[model samples]
Target chain A: MKNTFLNKKNLTWLILGVAFFFLIQLLIQVGVITPYYRVTMYWICLFAILGVSLNVIIGVTGQFSLGHAGFMSIGAYSAAVVLRSMPNLTGLFIGMAIGALISLFVSMVVAIPTLRLKGDYLAIATLGVGEIIRIVILNMKITNGASGISNIPYLISWPLMFFFVFVSIMFSANFKNSAIGRACISIKEDEIASEAMGINTTKYKVMAFMFGALIASLAGALYATTYYVIKPETFGINNSINILVIVVFGGMGSLTGSAVAAIVLGIINNVFQPLAEWRMIIYALALIVIMIFRPQGLLGTSEASLKTIFSLDTYKNALKGLIDLVTLKKFRVAAASTGKGKQR
Target chain B: MLEFLQQMINGLSIGSIYALIALGYTMVYGIIKLINFAHGDMYMIGAYVGMISVTTFKLPFVLALPATMIVTGVLGVVIERIAYRPLRKSTRVAALITAIGVSFFLQNAVSRIMGAKIYTFPPVLDNRTFMFYGLRFNTQQIAIFVTAILLMILLQVIVKKTKVGRAMRSVAVDQDAAKLMGVNVDRTISLTFAIGSSLAAAAGILVGIYYNTINPLMGFAPGLKAFVAAVFGGIGIIPGAMIGGFAIGLIETMVSGYGSTLYKDAVVYVILILVLIIKPSGLLGKNRKEKV
Candidate 1:
């Protein structure tokens, strides 16, 4: 009877979570929201989706990709070109879905041959692919050459965006709590050990890449349909880097960290409009500072959870505040005594 | 046949500029694994510095050449000290992203200072042509090819013969071991950037002369192509970049001349894809044993 009551309480929390998002959707539909806040929320949702997609590769898999924008470019242009040829609303939805699917297919074809390559080579291969995509699109008559394709489909509405964003975040959260997520983290922690332990590192690596590419393509499709325009330059290295920055700035291996980072960076981007030209400089400085002072990121490798907030307070009090403890802290203190962190 | 020769000449000349810039990527990638995305912007800076030195300071061309190299070299070392040195122990991916950030900062700062408009460099090269069998080699083109080869030889000698070069190779081979051996990894890295930047400076001045104009963002295309070249020649190998540079030049020029020039990047991208799929270690790079 007590267990049944506990299960009922968990069901209520899940329903409440659904209701909270439902309320936000209702507010938008009822026209109680301003366009400014509405647009910002829309971008935040889109980026949050993209950030989680990126987490599969950068955060969990422990690999770097400067080519994510290239995958996105594929989706954006895929949607743009297809919907133009087939403009029925259902056809457009099919196009967005197909566009994302095709991207997964192509990335798999590319990833299959190249994921086996050594460290940083994969990064370069991906980067090269990204550039190739942009350059090829730039020259394509279908893309209007340098002029870019316009009028994709303004048919994408706020409700659609919110629904897709919720689906995206939920998928990522669920992945974090699943076997696939554990497999990715295992590969990241030690590939050799994981392989020795029969984890099939290569399969996990390719799956992670495919999954990341799939989500990124979905984000690209959503962005394309909503904006009703797509330019090759729009999905350049800067887009990939921005996604990466959000991933790292949150926490490299944490899903919730990326969502929070995307939101913060999005707001920062909007607020710091005056620093447009100096944006890279600020980001570079921030990265350097973060690596020096807090390389673990704000959340570390741990995902954010309701219980984590309370655990954090206790952990802080038990270790540093209350009394000294053994373990890595003692080693760190010993290293400090030996003159670590003191520059010559 | 004459037209083919002309394309060859044209490609080799442009290839020289790419080769020169690629030396930076290959050399630094050789010692330190940092991609140094800002290396391209340093080329931009070199152009601006050339503009300032030749036009603003009113110096002779040859003197201004050395002057641009000096200033850009110092700037390269300073960036290493500031942005990268502290993050030395972090993951290579973090360093790569940071390099991109540094790149953005440099490009934007120059963009802000010089404005985004294209600025034409005053004609310092004599810009005359020598014709042979219907193929004409411009003074600038000849200069570019000759100077690039000379720089490659100089780089080869530096890496192969000098004590500093030995130290650099040592650090590249094993940073922790080199540090324990008292090789001063930081200083070697700075020197690597110094030499790399000087080469980029030379490429900048030549390209400025060839194009007769320089823009703030001019660094992006060439920078990327140089990176392509470095990879093509098998990164971390000195002679490979030289060959890769010329190879890229030939492909891009041939494609631009015969096919649609707009698809020039398509040629590079295809090569990149082919190289990665067929030979991940590159044509010249030997496979490294997995580090424990």
Candidate 2:
């Protein structure tokens, strides 16, 4: 376990990931890509982080939090406030750290009450909490009211943003594979069973929630830097729902799927920007269609295993398994309907 | 003293509307345990329908109100059929996300069709403020309060005395058992949605008249607040929802009247959080232990 991070395979993947991001940065710096494309990629990185972090809570832990955007707002404001004094790399790091700490605190505060309650109560509570956070920000003098905090220094360059995104992905993946992650999954599978097994459900639930909030705040810090503005309203229920959509669409509990969905949906958001009003309507419709047809999401619970990162056989087998599942589901649906008809 | 009475009067009117919407939320949640996020949009649609009936078709307020109720009620049924029924067996999170999706669809679709502008509701009743003693009240307030109370009483009688209502209660307790008992569970659920949505529609029209304005996105805030009200009252209980709605509405009005108007919405949310924290089952709800 101690040597795992230092192993050759892990180091190779790390290097490859860095190289891939660096190549993209080089393309942008050398004018090989449009500024718009560069911006879109930045959004992808931000959203991917958001999606993966939320997956830890909703997907892995099986808790519903409609307040990720509230945590994001906390991070955004904390980072922005810190940046007001120090607008350099040191400030960015300190700001993000501060943002993460605040988010963890807030998550703990929210979790203590709602985590003890039964089923989807947290969702409703968080929905209200998120709105409360936004409204409080609106009335606060420090947040500059509805005009929002703007014109922060751009400390999050493409490289820095990519590095943070990489860190988020790696951290989440490691967590997902670790003992604590397993505990979280067990709770999700069945909270009572896990509790009966002597698993401290509340402790793991809070930890996962705080971790998700930390990553969300980190994303928020990056969002504030990249866009150079942060508005309270932007981190409302709509934003929370958007992250939930990405998590559900990417297949909950599947980190790789979250990343993929985030990138895809981010691109879709940009492409449909011309018809601004229709974008949300289409996204909403897509959500309904996907839920109806593929409730398990595109990837379901299948995850990208690092051991099979470059294995063609693994990919083929996974694809074949997915096809089998789809056909099996179709057959079951047909048989059930016909069976009902026969009963009549 | 006069001002206090005025504020209380205002609070009751708004609270009546909240109670109406809250009933819808409570009824739907009672039956399905899913927060019909689109329920608020039903109210919004109802308001828009009322707006159309009055402005475009020149219908009277009485005619417009029922039209809005029927349209919104049917819309609720269709929404449940298309989005909710398929995902009933899935994870609660899936159903919730789908509800949010339906909400988004309704809000955006209405906005697109209506051009996203705030329309002034036509003057239905004459602006006649009657003063009794030291407190002043308007015709609109009286109409809203009277209509809201009558509707609530009617709902109470229906739910308490009717056969369909009994089926709804049975389904809420245990769906499989209800089905075994020869209840048409699906129809019962649809009927619940219909009744709830019609109440929300009534609230919407009343609010449109009181506020003298209508918009596509008007339902979002009030809808959320009404959910908070439902939770505050005891989510699955009918009377709890009514009490919760009035409490939230009064609290919001008072907060705005005495404190900062900006914190009004925040106050309602704060109430929701506090209620969940202190009493997750709400004021009227009995705490049920989850079974393994």
Give the candidate number with the greatest DockQ. 2
- Over A1-344, each residue of candidate 2 has an lDDT whose tens digit, in order, gives 45566887678778889789889878988988787787888888998999999999988998888889999998889888889999887887898899888788888988877787655677878888788888888889988889899998887677788888899999998888899999999998888899999999999999998999999999999998888988888898879988988998788889988998888888888888898779889879878766665666667677866666677875685565456445545633522332321110
**How far is A127's C-alpha from truth in model 2 (Å)?**
1.2
Error of 2 at A194 (Å): 0.9
- lDDT tens digits, residue span B1-292, model 1: 7888889999999998898889899988888777878888899899999988998899877798889999999999998887777666656666676677788778777877888899999998798988776779798888778877887888888888999989988988888899999998889999999999989988898889889899888898899889889989998888888889998999999999999877788678778778877876677988767654
Cα misplacement distance, residue B241 of candidate 2 (Å): 1.2
Give the backbone clash total of model 2: 0
How much lDDT does each candidate structure score?
Answer: 0.78, 0.86
The ten-residue window of minimal lDDT in model 1 chain A covers: A321-330
Candidate maximizing lDDT: 2
DockQ of prediction 1? 0.38
lDDT of 1 by residue, A87-143 (tens): 766766676788778888878887877787645667777887788778878878877
TM value for model 1? 0.90
Going through the candidates in the order shown, the clash numbers are 0, 0
Summarize candidate 2's per-residue lDDT along B1-292 as a digit string, tens digits.
Answer: 8888889899999999999999999999888889888889999988988889888999898888888889889988999888888777666666777888999999999999988889998899777998899789899999999999999999999999999878989999999999999999999999999999999999999998999999989999999999999999999999999998888888988999999999998888888888888987899999877665
Q: State fnat for each of the candidate structures.
A: 0.40, 0.57
